[model samples]
Target: MNNKIKSFLKSFTLFEIFLITIGITLVTTFSIVFGANPLAICSSVIGIIGVVFIAKGSVIGSVLGIIMSIFYIIVSYINGLYGEVVLYVLVIIPMNILSIIQWFKNVSQDKVTIKVQKTAKKDLIILAIATIIAIPIVYIILKFFNTQSLILSTFSIIISTVGTYLNVKRDKLTFIVFILHNLVVISLWIVTIINIQNLSLIPIIVNSSVNLFSNMYGVINWTKMQKKQNQKGSY
Candidate 1:
């Protein structure tokens, strides 16, 4: 047991990478038949786990985080969660790149510990104000476009403000911000599924387009990020 612990302490671990990859792959493949709920669950679980694991200083965890990033964004996009989708495409994608760079630097330090910086009170206030701004944006979008239900639509806006802030800023606030936003999103999903209908092929296809993209992004980026990390570590 001592030797095992020592080995674990001295070496880099990829178990999380493999696990998250397998999960996302399964969730991606499964979304076709099981509908969007299961797919979104995969994304959510990946994100929550990724947040905790990354903070614990796992490179694989960071890789998994990128996967979650892509997964949620895509899921949001597909479910007519337009505002959230936009945040994914814009904020989340850029944040993924930053996370990769940050994690890579840590690996070079010959240590496995990750640092979660503190977030400022001012920043939290800014985030709250952003949410207030999102209200009008949500209102305008819903009014102009025939999007999904009001709850889901509004929730999408709220996530965009909070999630974007968390992804861009690496601090203790990230966890709390993610937790609160995810709860709201989960609530929105539960409400949505309560009235889910068996729609025709066309509707399903259009609805699932964003989800498919989300899975695709997570799988592809995770693979690329892991490969890059591995190569860097070897040198």
Candidate 2:
């Protein structure tokens, strides 16, 4: 039993464990103090963990991402963040699954390290066109549903769409997109918290802070990984 436990624990890095602990502690304390919805707190905790794993370039993160998307969709629905609900349910969940396949198919010889790719100009052009097409459609849906923080919510969908697309392609640009997404999300949640005047929303703020840190770390780490791949002529 001791060996089994140690082996299982070895699967995660020290930083990953630290992030998980912090997420759990924040959620637990906030839920106790603010009478926050336990489900939302739990979902935020899981989502933080998933983001940490994604920063490490692990396909397991994508699996966790799918689970996080489900919980986030539920939380967003209750909060009337219609754009968030649609983004998670319609885009994030499916993209996470696709990311899992892509990452797995691009692993190193050790089968543990996933290779990062670069985005081309054509990719940017395609994404730009897609964003232009998607914005109006998402705006119509959010407007119809009377979504909270309507403009911010619609903007989040746009950011998330670009971020997830880059992630699925293993582009190093994904972390940059995540940084932007995190900013938009922080603003979106802040508006919601102010409007509702609830301390319960504090956990979402904590979650976004952690996500911002994770994305910053991801940018640094993925850059190093890309350099290493380039050194080895791995493309």
lDDT of 2 by residue, 79-102 (tens): 889899989988899999899898
Best by TM-score: 2
Those runs of model 1 whose alpha carbons end farther than 4 Å from true positions after fitting are 1-49, 55-59, 69-75, 104-110, 198-235
Candidate 1, residues 1-235, lDDT tens digits: the string is 9997987755533644444455445445545555546556666556544543554445655577568767667665666656666656666666666766775664433355443344588977887887788787876776566555665556655664565455445444454455455555545555555546422112223223333333334334334444554565632
- Model 1 weakest lDDT span, ten residues long: 198-207
Give per-model TM-scores: 0.57, 0.91
CA lDDT, every prediction? 0.53, 0.85
Steric clash pairs (candidate 1) = 74-214
